[model samples]
Each structure stands twice: as C-alpha cells, then as structure tokens.
Target chain A: MQNENLYKELLRRFRLKVTLTRLHVLDVLANTPVALSHADITEQLAEYDIDKVTLYRTLNAFTKCGLAHKVATEDRNWLYALHMPDDAPSEVTSDHAHFVCDECERIYCLPMETGNNTRDIKEEQGFVIRSQEYRLHGTCPECHTQFSQQ
Target chain B: MQNENLYKELLRRFRLKVTLTRLHVLDVLANTPVALSHADITEQLAEYDIDKVTLYRTLNAFTKCGLAHKVATEDRNWLYALHMPDDAPSEVTSDHAHFVCDECERIYCLPMETGNNTRDIKEEQGFVIRSQEYRLHGTCPECHTQFSQQ
Candidate 1:
C-alpha cells in the first residue's frame, strides 16, 4: 500500500482521528521491518517538528488499537513495530518471537508457527494467558559478519 | 540468608567494597520474593538514605555478575530479583520460569524446565541465537481462587 492510503485506512479501521504527526509516525513504522524504540522514532521524526508527548500518545493508541505491537527491550523501554492488520483475523498482538541485536540494538519480530496450544500453560494455575511475546536475542546476520571480519 | 550476611556476600562475590547503601538495596531486593523495579526499591528504601544513582550502578554491577536476573514487565522499567545461589553447581544462573502475578504485581520464580533448544529457530534465520528469557503472566493460584469465590 502507498503511504497516504495506508495511514487513511489505519485511521478508518482503528477509528483514530487522522493527523499529520500520526500519519508520519505510522508511515515511518510501516516502512521498517524491525521494531523501533521511542528514541528511534524521535530521532527519525525530528525533522517533522512533532511533539514528544504526541508521539507517546500516538504509539500508545496504536498499541492499544492493534495497529502495532510492543517489544520490551533490555534498556526498559518499549520497541514497537507495524503489525500488519490483515495477517491474523482475531486481533493484532505480538505472539511472534523477537530478535534484539546486541550490537546495533535493533529488535526484529521472528514469525513462528500459528495455532500453538497455550492451554497447558493456562491449565496449571487457572490463569488466563491471553497473549505471548517471545524474544531471541543475538547479533543480526549483518552485524555477525561485521564482528567476525573485525 | 539473613540481611547482614547476604549484604557482605554480595560485596565479596561482586568484588565491590562493602557500602551502607548497596547493602540496604540488596536487603530490600533479597527479602522480597517479587522482582522489584528501581523505583520500587527507592520507595521502599527511602529511609536508608541511598542515592538513586548509586542504586542504579549497584544494580548494573549485580546484573553483570549474575547475582541477579532482570525480569521484563509491561511498565518498561528494569525489574530485578536476586539470583539465589543454587546447590547444584551446574545450574548457577537462573534458567527457571518466572511468573508475574496480575493481582499482586509480584514476580515469582517457579521451579521448572529450562534450556529449550533453539536450533530449529536458528534454521529460519541463519543466525546464531543466544540466551532467551521466558516469563509467564497471570493470576497466582491464590488470587485465582479468591476471584472465583467473589
């Protein structure tokens, strides 16, 4: 999907009031494959003159509305990514595994097999396990090769 | 382990000189079963007269030395629990499952299996995956029963 239409559709589907800053934020995230931290977005969108609070609120709303998913990094801030809306029918969540690059500090969502039974986990405590986010940390292929070269 | 002994051992094991503030911080974390955020420790140890910066540094050292493990929570603050030294020499570091209680906001380490293979996961990425932390979140059995009764 083109930039303008993606944001327009996102706003319509999420019932979010469309705004330039929000669209720009969405656009930046949509184009990227790996998840991004708030610092990443702030630096990336610094040219746009967007307010920090607006960015926070926009990301928070997108996360709540199933337009994006949050990956918790070691540094204790959320790394988020565009969760393609049309992939899974039920809801948008980060059930997929993640890879946090130790050197570059990038987080990527590694897709896993779907229909994984979580009942064994839930039955143990009568606990409702709603969603799962699994992360596997390592150097990315690019970083791994660079480290070996050095 | 008692407070005084634990504090002294922490200093010796981590190769830091024994200090009043570090001891207090260590005591607070060790006494509590729940994984504590820095903010949580600060609030609880307010009377101990420790500097926040010192506390953060101490935590970083402890994490590096394998004296503690960081548990990921939704709040985006690094939460830590003391890694109790195990009797088994082979299993020094914590490879156990951790449970985060929804009602109590406590993180409990449940004794269970660990070191699940990632060789298959690596096949998908052609990347050498390193360590992983798996945390399960839910109401504890106690809370589950209480909620059901109500």
Candidate 2:
C-alpha cells in the first residue's frame, strides 16, 4: 500500500535501516490517532510475534531520527506517536496538547489553541527549548458520563 | 524546628501516620526546589537506611492525599514535588509549568505565566479536568552555556 511505501521512504529519509519491525511500528503509529505506549504497540503487533528488544530498538531509532516523539504519562509509560511535518496535520503530532483520562488512563490529542506559546518563557528563563509537551489530566467525556451514571 | 512542626501538622491534617521515614521524605520534598524521582529521594535518604517498599508506600500515600504531585519525565520516571496550597508560593507546585533539561535531565519549576490557561480547552473539549501539568523540555542555562562554549 501507499502507506507502507511512505513508511519505507521515511525510514530511508531518516537513514534508518529498512526492517519489517520498523515498518510495522510505523504503520501502527500512523493509524493510531493518539499516542500509544510500547505495550500498546506490542499488543497491536501481536500477530507478528516481534521480539521485544527489536521493537524497542526500532522505536528508539525512530525517536532519535525525529520520525516519532514520545509523551510521558502519569503511570510512567512513554506514549509514542509520529512526528508529522508542519505542513501535515495529524492528530498524533505535538502541535497541540494531550488530554489523559485519569479514570481510564486513556490519552487523547486536543486541538491546538493560541496564546499558549512558550517563547516568552524561553526568553525570560534563558532556556534553550528544543521541544515542549503540554498534558492535561482529567476525566474524558465517556468517563465523565460513566461517573455521572454511577 | 518550625519546619518540622509544619511537616508534622501536614501529616496530621492528611491523616497519614507520623513516622520518621515519612518525616524524612517530607523534609526531602519540602527542601528540594525541583521535583525528584524515587531514586533521587532514595539517594538523599541513604543515611536513614529506609526500606524501598516503605519509601514507595509513603510516597504513594503522600501523592494519594494530595501532599505531593508527580510529573512524568522523558525517561519515564515520575518526579515527585510538593503540592502547595494556592496561598503558598513554592517552586514545586503545579501552579506553573516545569522545564526538564534534555542534556542534564534536571527538572526546574518555571514561573506561572498568563495566557496559558487550560480553561478554554476544557470548555471546548468537554473534559472534566481535575488538574493539569505543563512540561517544557530543553537545555537549562548551565547546559546551554556549556553547549555554546563547546
């Protein structure tokens, strides 16, 4: 499929070796709208019987090459998502903040809004900010409804 | 000391049993300007010969009772800090964002700034937000300076 080809091209672009595990991981990340932890990815790729160390190494390579980024969750799990280019609009990108449902431990990508820029902080605090992550912890709509019903 | 009494008072208010281990942990958290992981806290309390399980339990109790808040870091370590009341100004509170230095992996508490409120996101997204944590990743002043010099 075109996505598979694109994943291959991305791997080549990032100078990463083209491996089946990397491609599979990319496919999983691309299809997932929200970031997923390593465990989630492993579950999704269960049919492949991918080696755990291989999968971890593949993810690390992707992260180091800017192909993906990881978000830290409250449970100390790092959720991995693709890093889409600025021109590409993707739900999993770091362009916006993420909402984590405290009750269910699910992560959702929230839309980006204005007036939350970190440039001022960088200037004032003298920090060389390479990246930033904004995470909101709360009850999602489904969990809110469930709690209300309870 | 006056601070010791305050720690005891806090433990009493939170209904946590007053113990030497708890007191030491609170003292460590209270004195630290930046958040610390369990390992960091353990290192700080090495002289006390505290049990790992007991330390973890005490931390969990403190976190459950809202005496402390944990911020997830890049390495999947949860950095623990005190959750000061709104009237109290503390460097470790969630009132502001946190900055983690990628080079040194040191976490610093940034001052709260205007125009970064999450109320609008909550209204638009329909999430029942209990608390929010904003994290910025970059190089700290020392690391930046070192990198620049290098």
Top lDDT prediction, candidate number: 2
Give model 2 RMSD, 1 decimal: 3.8
User: For residues B63-89, what per-residue lDDT tens digits would candidate 2 score against the true structure?
Assistant: 887788777777778788887655433
lDDT of 2 by residue, A106-133 (tens): 8876555557766565757688776566
Candidate 1 residue A145 Cα shift, in angstroms, is 2.0
Give the alpha carbon lDDT tens digit for every residue of B32-135 in model 1: 76789889999998887678898889888777777777877877678888776663212223344566677877777655444344435564665656655555
Q: What is the DockQ of each candidate?
A: 0.43, 0.63
Instruction: Please provide, for model 1 over A17-50, each residue's C-alpha lDDT reduced to its tens digit, 9 standing for 90 to 100.
Output: 8888888999889888789888889999989888
DockQ of 1: 0.43
> Which residue ranges in model 1 land beyond 4 Å of their true spot?
A87-94, A112-122, A125-127, B1-3, B87-97, B110-112, B115-119
Error of 2 at A98 (Å): 1.7
User: Considering only N, C-alpha and C atoms within 3 Å, which residue pairs clash in candidate 1?
Assistant: none
